[model samples]
Target: MKKVSCIFIVDDDPITVFGIKKMLKSVASCDDIQIFQNGHEAHEAIKERLKEGKIIPEVVFLDINMPIMDGWEFLDELIALDIKEHITINMITSSIDPLDYKKWNGFKNRCPYTLNFKNKPIFKIEANDLGCMDIAS
Candidate 1:
């Protein structure tokens, strides 16, 4: 599998972020890892990077519920930006609501880049299964 260059974890929960980061560090060979507490911050930073012609993350782990902007809103803004790079997005949330799943499925249909829906507290196995690990290793 291709090695991921950069990754972004966009979630409000500090504990979740820490756990995900730890898991990724153990399993993946990504070069850069960025953390954002909310979608608004992530969105602004991404836009700034785009404007500056800087490297954007190849993968994004986004949570559904946040203070400034929610995951769905983030997706809307992201798609509207028309970013040229192919960034895979995984919806990582604790929401077990059927409606959330439905919405995520709908978003996946609309945006092919949205890869999978993962629950909170991502595991090493799941990360590896998602092709996030270094296959050459």
Candidate 2:
């Protein structure tokens, strides 16, 4: 598999962000790894990039729960935009609620390019739930 050039980590937790970043670095070769503290920031950046006719991130590791614009909200707004290219949206979250899966499935239906969401129990050197090598590759 080919490596991703650009990746976006959209999460509010600093610890989670750091863990993901480290895992990605160890497992794959990504030239640009951008971090967004919340979905709103990530959403804005995506829109800006689209407007400027710049290349969007190839992959997005999104967290479900967040303040000032959750993952669902971001996806809702995103689907409205004219994004023709494919983007692998990985909903990396700790929540195991049934509703989360249900909601995610709906988004999956709407988003043809998005991958199934992953609920990670832990992020570490030995990847399991955070399949950085597979995802990045």
lDDT of 2 by residue, 59-110 (tens): 8888989999999998888788758877777888899799999998888887
What are the runs in model 1 whose C-alpha is more than 4 Å off?
Answer: 125-137
RMSD of each: 2.8, 3.5
RMSD of model 2, in Å?
3.5
lDDT tens digits by residue: candidate 1, 1-137: 34678888999889988887787766667778899999999999899999998898888888999998999999989998988777878888888999999998888888846467887656652544334445534
Candidate 2's C-alpha runs over 4 A off are 122-137
Give me the overall lDDT of model 1: 0.81
